[model samples]
Target chain A: MKKIIQFIVLAFVLLPGVARAQEAAGSINDMWSFPVVYAYDEEVTWFFDLSTTTFAAESDVYLWIWSPSEPDAGNWENSSEFAKLTYEGDMIWSFTLTPTEYFNMTPEDIAASAGFWFRLKDLTGSLQSEVHSMAYTDYSSFAGSGELWRSYPSSPLIDEGVSILFNANLAEGFEDATSIHFHSGLNFWDIAVEYQSWIPEVVEKTQLKNMGGGIYKMDLIPQEYYEAPDGYVMENIAFLFVKDDWAGTTADQVLYAGEFIPPPPPVFTFFPQQISKKDFLGIIRTNNEPGINTLIYTVTAGTVEVTGEITGGVSEIKGFVNLVSALQNVDVTEIHVLVKDNTDRTISDTTIPLKQLD
Target chain B: MRSKIIYGLAIMGLIAVGCNDPDDGSYVDPVTIYEKMDGDWGLMSLNMVDEYAKANAIEPSEQNMGAYFNYEDFKIRFSVDDNMEPTTYEVMGDVPPLFPANGYWKLSSAFQQPNGEAVKIYLYSDAQKTQMTDELKLVAVPGSGEQMELQLVRKSGGIAFVSYSFKLNAVN
Candidate 1:
């Protein structure tokens, strides 16, 4: 009886240890909190969801904050050693730590500390989630050397094929900048103004031209990048400028592409291609779109031009021109109708052969 | 015995401090002006008659007076939260086909009614909200707190470009 009892006790202890040592199936799903890009003074409480797989009591989890120097290393600062995550409701583990607390630096040190990253790991430190980078920006740090402003294309609308003369004054530290990259994304305005997390596609970086003093300029022809079909209006195009470690992304500039649209052809009916001198020539016509300021109707009978203006938007406009006097001496005449808009765009249709009526 | 009594009181004080709940029962949701204007607002009808038309000796007709102003087959909706981006615009009309109405809207705190009776809301055509497409005066309908009207005015250099009076009925 004593031997059987010892075997049962040993089995209970060994089985649990083997099961706990086994690798867990799933990983951490998501880590979230308010104010992703934290200010120096703000205290952030991050809640990590571990609902995917529950571990045995013997198993453990950890958090690692990657330092700026150790870019390639998996294990950097073991945040779990200092701050242990307390159990929160709904299988979420909570840890309260500030940027200043983690880095041992205050908000005033953000200019030197640009790139920072963090991640969560298991006890063995083998299983982990993707690293989350921190993008720290402060008004003072952003305008470190001096303030910058953009001139030209004051409004967001720009004509296609025309080079936008983009001119700006660089800050003090940015004078040594070698290149400026252009980054763009569609529908940036639709992203939440406060927590805009969408990443923009970076276009190729090019060297900047120093145009005397502290002024810099770039003549960017948009058509080269955006293939806007004829009469097409591209919308929600967000663009920004970035330089090498000198300046952060400048304020976003959103623009609309306004290409020229040609006017549509006018529709009209001038029946009876052949007309008689005594018969009145009735010309009727209309345009698909409005804005017809004036319409001129003309008839030519070999070196003789007779014309009259027709006004208004009508599907059927019947007007009779008395060629009885003009064609009285002629045998035949050709009829023409011209339509025009306020912008000086014109379209016309012609009818031929007006034999003198017996 | 006296030292033990004093130690007991000190431990009890620490316990009381630790037991205090950070979240009090008193929590009120704030009702901001933007929340009131957030929803799907259908445009039933629109008319934009320019002051220049009257000066140009033009007749006051829908066709002649505002010939350039075309507001047909279009619907606009405002989002409630901070994610109210112009890209998420629910444009219900032919406007998006030709002139993409990636509408964005925001309330201008700078301009308010002198009497403080109304708020000014700025509307934009693109997602960036950089271009000022229209300016609207949002006011609650008389006697109806839930119902409202948006009066939009387009002007330039003291000349009336277009005046749009919209009766927005909430669909959502």
Candidate 2:
């Protein structure tokens, strides 16, 4: 008698569900929500109205939310449950998307889209609704709305070991910007040549000082690649601003430090522009260059070539170069001088006019 | 027609060659040593021959030289007239020379030598120019064309020669 009573109750409870599962067929008519203007990590509820044919009014419903990036049912990014409906007046099935649910989305996805698309299904998983997308225009406005407060120095002319100032102001979703990094190398022309294969040659972390109001200032001293062998020639450097808390990043772009200039072109002035047959003093004045230990110069005129070295300082080299043998043969001669720094960098090339004095 | 084309090419080559002027914007006016050296000069300092002997480190003897030359009480003046003739006046202790201490000087970029070519400034004691007091090799320090230094080299044959240096400033 006890088993019969339990079977009757069970059959009665499941009989209606079985019948409803076979007969009940309805399409999700529309999904409606309100109060689109909300801050990040704010929870909101969505209402779904279903047009039923033969389903009971007290059936259970489930809500499935998805990121627009991957909207397939197998890969439904997220899901939420709607409370049981007890009120008989309005057959409105509603789902509450908690703040934790919204925060679970990836930063990249939240930055890209205002709201996610969702689908509705019953507990049996037999009947499903079509996929629909919704966006909170007010809330979505804050997504991906990051912009640079001030323009970086456009092609600033800088020297090696000089302090370069960098300032940026972030607003909206970029409020958490904690650090700024400067990525250099891969010049303007190299980017085109390497195409997508370009990577930063050097990355330097700049120290930042907060000036409130989302404004950050830093003095970046680029030690690496400052004295590059080829030297900097108006090459473009990229600065990346990152919010480490959420792993948010600003797109990489060129700072255009104007041009990386090398020491002034090797220049020299020679005394006695007019050298007589008797050996006269010639002072070759070379501009001081960094790391220059010796100045190797070649004096070439007509067919005579004499190579000499200045060991002490590159600033000035004074001595009597034995040009008597070289110039005694010609009436009026032109002496070509080629000078190079210790690094074998050509500093200057000039010619001196000499005449045999009577 | 072929000859006409050849003539056109020849004319173009000649035009290109004529446009190649290496002396463009490189003209430097050459100033002779006589022009730059014609100024009033005063001796500033002197490098004593050997201070080691004055320190009482060496024994007293006549061979120990006290000093080579002293110019504290004497100021020499050089004058170059428009005729290019040079004259000198030696003043001793605010008193002018009693006998018109006149001398002649010459500046030349070359004096025939085997190896080194140097600017030689010759100072003769008389108008007839029989005696010479000094023959200095003037080398303008690199970068400062206005200043000239004459190294007070010693009389030793070897490495002791190039030790002393004297500076001459242009006061005029």
What TM-score do all the candidates reach, one by one?
0.24, 0.29
Clash pairs detected, candidate 1? A277-A357
**Model 1 lDDT per residue over A214-326, tens place:** 44444333434444333333454566655654365566776544432544566655432334443344454554344444556666667777777656563434344555455
Interface RMSD (C-alpha) of each candidate?
22.5, 18.7
Q: After superposition, how far is residue A135 of candidate 1 from its true place, in Å?
A: 99
Report lDDT (Cα) of residue B98, candidate 1: 20
What residue pairs clash in candidate 2, if any at all?
Answer: A155-A256, A155-A257, A155-A258, A156-A257, A156-A258, A266-A347, A279-B117
lDDT score for residue B92 of model 1: 70
| Each candidate's clash count | 1, 7
Error of 2 at A50 (Å): 77
Model 1 residue A18 distance off true place after TM-score fit, in angstroms: 99
- Where is model 2 chain A poorest over a 10-residue stretch in terms of lDDT? A192-201
Q: Looking at model 1 chain B, which ten-residue stretch has the lowest summed lDDT?
A: B61-70
Alpha-carbon shift of residue B46 in model 1 (angstroms)? 1.1
State what share of the real interface contacts each candidate retains.
0.00, 0.00
The per-prediction CA RMSD against the true structure, in angstroms, equals: 35.8, 31.5
Q: Kindly report which residue stretches of model 2 are placed more than 4 angstroms away from their true locations once superposed.
A: A1-182, A185-221, A224-266, A281-283, A301-303, A312-320, A325-332, A345-351, B1-172
